[model samples]
Target: MSSLQDIPVHVAAEWGNALPVLHEIRHALERLAETGEARVIDLNAMPFGPGDEDRLLGLLGQGEIEARLDALGVTQIRETAVPGVWLVDHRNADGERLVLHVEIAEVPAILRTQAEDLRDAVAALDARLATGASPFPHRPDN
Candidate 1:
């Protein structure tokens, strides 16, 4: 038997052709700066190898916010270390990743409140106020 010291270890840094995807992300950022239009890049469409996704995610780092929504399926949205960049992951009920995308914008559109929803909320608040129900009752001071 050979000693452990005799074994040779080969280490290689592999990005798996992820440079092109990085370039695309840079271009998207430029477009957002120039036109104020958000860009979405679908990672599922790219030919990413085993370690490529890890590399890309490592570069982006982590952010402060994370949100999850369950409708027809479960959707997870997270912001990257970059201020205006967000990662959106959608998984089916079976827990399979269905969509993986990077959105370049101030905020992802899916997380934004719709005008109709806001209107409904406002109406509800108005109705509640009209009832004149005091959330806190007046207490006599001793």
Candidate 2:
């Protein structure tokens, strides 16, 4: 086996066309902060070549929270190191990436519970309680 130093490593000098996309991401973040309007940047729409995705991911980095939803397909939501910025990845049943989005917002809309859903949940709990089917059945005081 050859020494580790003998191996050749190739490093690209610059980010190429990805700089414009990064700038767009920054502007979207500002817009979200000021107007509370979320923006999504679709990577597929951009002219991204090899290694560009990895570079962008490095810049955003991983954040505190990550979630996955499996309904019609698989949806993954991950926050970046920068607050209010998220990466939403959606894949079909065949495991192909259907959408790769960089969303700038206080929270990604996909991860938020809708008002109607909350109301329905409250109504359900109230009905269960009225039916004497308490969710907490093993109460020490009772």
Candidate 3:
């Protein structure tokens, strides 16, 4: 049998950035667990070697929840296989990426309704009820 030193492992000339990203995620997760503080990492701001991003994403894998929002542009939010980890993509109308964020939280902030919107919704609901319109958009399936 050949000596262990004879093994051929192809190493890249430059270090892979994927592990660093994972490290960041791991630390952020720890902070979140300890302090309930969420962290967001901007992937665009990081330097990525060839295949680094793909490797990182592959490692993250996919989870159950996905959300798509379209306003001025499109925003895609997906949960990673790791609980409390999320991937968020903000894209322009032209399908260009504006920001790519890895968010560590129970749920990504983008999914939460803002206080201003919630207050407005309260007023809107009262007005609709005052107008005697059916409050329920769809009747119960009784």
Candidate 4:
């Protein structure tokens, strides 16, 4: 099997954007650390040649968190091995990819809890508390 470093990290010369994107990610990471600023880079906007995307994703590798959300369709969020770097994929109901983004932040914006969701959660918790119900179902000990 080819090692990660053996994988060339650049796109075809004419589509020379992948390596620069890595540099951009690095800078964005620095900015996020120094100031609480975050960044989102749209991968679909770039002209990536064959194998370039794979190479980039390979370099980033996989981190500890992976999340899948279904609101309209499906959105997959994953953290890269590097801290504060996340990969987000948004797909339509038909499962076609609509956008791919590299988001440099503690958590990708798509994965963050929305205000509406917060309100619903709060209301549900308040109701549960008023009813004096346990969130967990009762289980008999063996």
Candidate 5:
């Protein structure tokens, strides 16, 4: 098995809304969990930006992200920051890690029906960005 140093930064996203894009984040974590051993650092929930830190704690408790990760058996670490990005580290059976970086925003009703598709769409965006390709506007394939 590879040590933590073997972990590769395969996925990452900037700060954004914890609720609007959380489903995609869960899907990413699910993909990582499927590999059996993976860790995700959720920086979106962290306090950041002007007046965003104004709240000591709002109605959106921290439980949402943590609970989802626990259900997936994926390790999750949280930090404070802007509200739109999420970073994930994925692992393979060989114990090699690949990072999955994501930029999550509100998914339109057209694409929000299924959970897996949302994940795939976001992952696709990450792939495009990594390859230095421009993202064509997402049209609902459904």
Candidate 6:
């Protein structure tokens, strides 16, 4: 398996734009499952209460997320855990831990609104910059 590195972490407030990236990653995981490279774990509907991982496992056996993955043509062992950098307990070729970043969650609405505002602000800033003008707001403190 491979590890994640050099991934840019930008402060994006655009949930709409971010959705495409999530969709693309999900599609890639589906493809990986098809090629037996990796499994597609459906964490989107994973329960968040106490003992969630165990709950998900139990429910999966009851054919919840498993049915969804199967319908999507994914065939591999699947489970959901906390979303973050999961460091594999097993060592790799270089005696290093294999880490995977699990980013699973719906984008917040506040972020989308902020991102649109930021986009408009940046466009205005650029126009001011092109006109050789300072775009900073004049405040009494300044």
Candidate that would win on TM-score: 3
Error of 2 at 139 (Å): 8.9
Q: Please identify model 6 stretches exceeding 4 Å from their true place.
A: 1-13, 39-100, 103-142
Q: What overall lDDT goes with each candidate model?
A: 0.85, 0.84, 0.89, 0.87, 0.40, 0.37
TM-score for each prediction? 0.73, 0.75, 0.81, 0.76, 0.22, 0.21
lDDT (10s digit) by residue, model 4, range 3-32: 977987664354555788999999999999
What is the C-alpha RMSD, rounded to one decimal, of candidate 4? 6.5
lDDT string for model 3 (1-142, tens) is: 3786598756566457899899999999999999999999999998987678878999999999999989669999999999989999999999899999999999899899988899899898687677755758875333
Models ranked on TM-score: 3, 4, 2, 1, 5, 6
- Segments in model 1 whose C-alpha atoms lie over 4 Å from true places: 1-15, 124-142
Q: Model 5 has how many clashing residue pairs?
A: 20
Which 10-residue span in candidate 4 carries the lowest summed lDDT?
133-142
Clashes of 4: 0
The digit string of per-residue lDDT tens for model 6 on 30-92 reads 555466343323343433343444333443233112111131232232223322111112224
RMSD of each: 7.5, 5.8, 8.9, 6.5, 18.8, 20.2
Clash counts for all predictions: 0, 0, 0, 0, 20, 1
Question: Which has the higher TM-score value, candidate number 1 or candidate number 3?
Answer: 3
Off by over 4 Å in 4: 1-15, 127-142
What is candidate 1's lDDT per residue for 1-142, written digit by digit as tens?
A: 3787588745366746577888888888888999998999999998886678878988888999999989668999999998788999999998789999999998899898988889899887787666656644863232
lDDT of 3 at 3: 81
